[model samples]
Target chain A: MPLDAMTDVSDEALLVLFANGDQMAARALTLRFTPKVMAHAYRLLGNHAEAEDVTQESMLRLWKIAPDWRQGEAKISTWLYRVVANLCTDRLRRKPGLALDAVPEPEDNAPGVTERIQDHTREVALQKALNQLPERQRQAVVLRHIEGLTNPEIAAIMEISTEAVESLTARGKRTLAAKLAGQRNELGYSDD
Target chain B: MNWGIAMTERKFDPVDLDHLFARVREHPAQPSADLMKRVLTDAYDAQAAVTPVTAPQLPGAPWLLQVFRELGGWPSMAGLTTAALVGVWLGISPPDGLVATADSFFGTDDDAYLIDVAPEATFEIAEGFLQ
Candidate 1:
């Protein structure tokens, strides 16, 4: 079957096939999950190159454990999400001077004001504000809001309780709101 | 306490905050193609290394048959085990046939025969004695 067609295949089945040494299954899984991981990493690290590295390393770890992957214990994407999050944290720690304010713009020629001023700008501003948060809070917020994960899932990914995830996200969002409040009007969010 | 509760009951509603924050989630950036390729390659390489080596297809033998062929055939192990058991049995119990052969080759008076034998003893004498 074509690699792209494997998108409909369940992660559990791909994992089983990967465990059995099916290269196609491995490729299928990599193609399926890499984008999500890379997007998460980029949001967390704010550096496309570093995010790419983290994504690669995270996927490599996934592949390395494929043979021993146990189904029903946890979702594969969840495992990958956690791994990428941890890797981004490690990268952040290694370079304390790396500021979150330095997120790169897309390479495409300068987008028109409408394109530039779209919802993505808000997302970038939110990501920057999120980066200013403590690591746990940032992770909690990213996992909960950006990733659209349930509180329980976020808790599991962060290795914390659901309550903790909720608290962290709440605090993180409050901090983000305060930080981004100045940009709200510029980002087209002002009620006036 | 009731007065304090009434005083503290009023706070900024979080719904406004939720509404404002809702736009923050709208446009997540897509991963670049280069990044995607790197991740997929890494995952593929890792899976290749850790995946178990199952039997491969061959023209002459199916996977199972190839496995059996690699295992040196069933009869080989049985033959080796039988040989080992026979060797153990022979080691514990000396072979009567060998003992009989040795006895026939060297008769009861072999000691006297050795004593009488000399470097100069002729082949003729030995043949005559045997006859």
Candidate 2:
């Protein structure tokens, strides 16, 4: 199938196609998911290199599980999110006390120099604050705030109740606010 | 005016977390082409493992077994099993036409062509020719 034609197909169906030896399905899946997985892993791990590793490994696992993938039982993104989260957790556990300051500034040139600097600082501050959050809370916050998933989706990925998801994200935001509160001026956020 | 003090005092209003962290989405880390190639190769490998391969042809297999294998090994076995069951059922209750059909198709009576050649008749013919 053409790439555009496969765009409308569900991830589960694409996986089934992939298992059945359709190379186009594999291409479509990789094109659709690698970036999201990488971003999720990056936010959770706070290191680009580790995030890339997690993304590749998570995707490899996804490929391996494609044959036995049960459609309609679970969404592909949900499964990948769980895998990336667990993988990131393992990496974090192995090397605890990861330094957030080492995160390289993202490359962007569309915005003005001043705006880019402010955005980079805000992002760095957010990453630092997110690192301060407890594991589950951090996962919830990133999935909810940064990844822009719904509370129910976050609950599914985190394997927790919707209420629990809400509470975690709420607490996470509060903690981030508190952590970055002192740097408001430095982050370019002026007082009202 | 300090936000951290407000949060400590339980008086801090919830900030717009979505808008605050939106920059992260704008500049996500991307997988390099090398990583994409590696992933696709792995996918192809897994796909190969999942797909069923054709069984290699066994040289000098019996025709019957070959027929069965062609129909898919299991289906061929099933067909043979059904045939055996029907044969057993016929043995238990022979049909009227079955006897006639068997006699016409299998009986050797009045079929001289199927009988063995007489050795005496061949000898007599050879002796007459020699004389």
What's the TM-score of each model vs. the native?
0.68, 0.76
Error of 1 at A99 (Å): 4.3
Candidate with the greatest TM-score versus the true structure:
2
Q: Model 2, B74: alpha-carbon shift in Å? A: 5.8
Off by over 4 Å in 2: A1-5, A101-111, B1-17, B55-74, B77-97, B100-131
Docking category of candidate 1: acceptable
Error of 2 at B69 (Å): 6.1
A29-85, model 2: which lDDT tens digit per residue? 988999899888888988878888899899999998888888788799999999998
lDDT of model 2 at position A123: 82
Model 1, runs deviating above 4 Å: A99-112, A115-120, B1-26, B51-131
lDDT of 1 at B126: 75
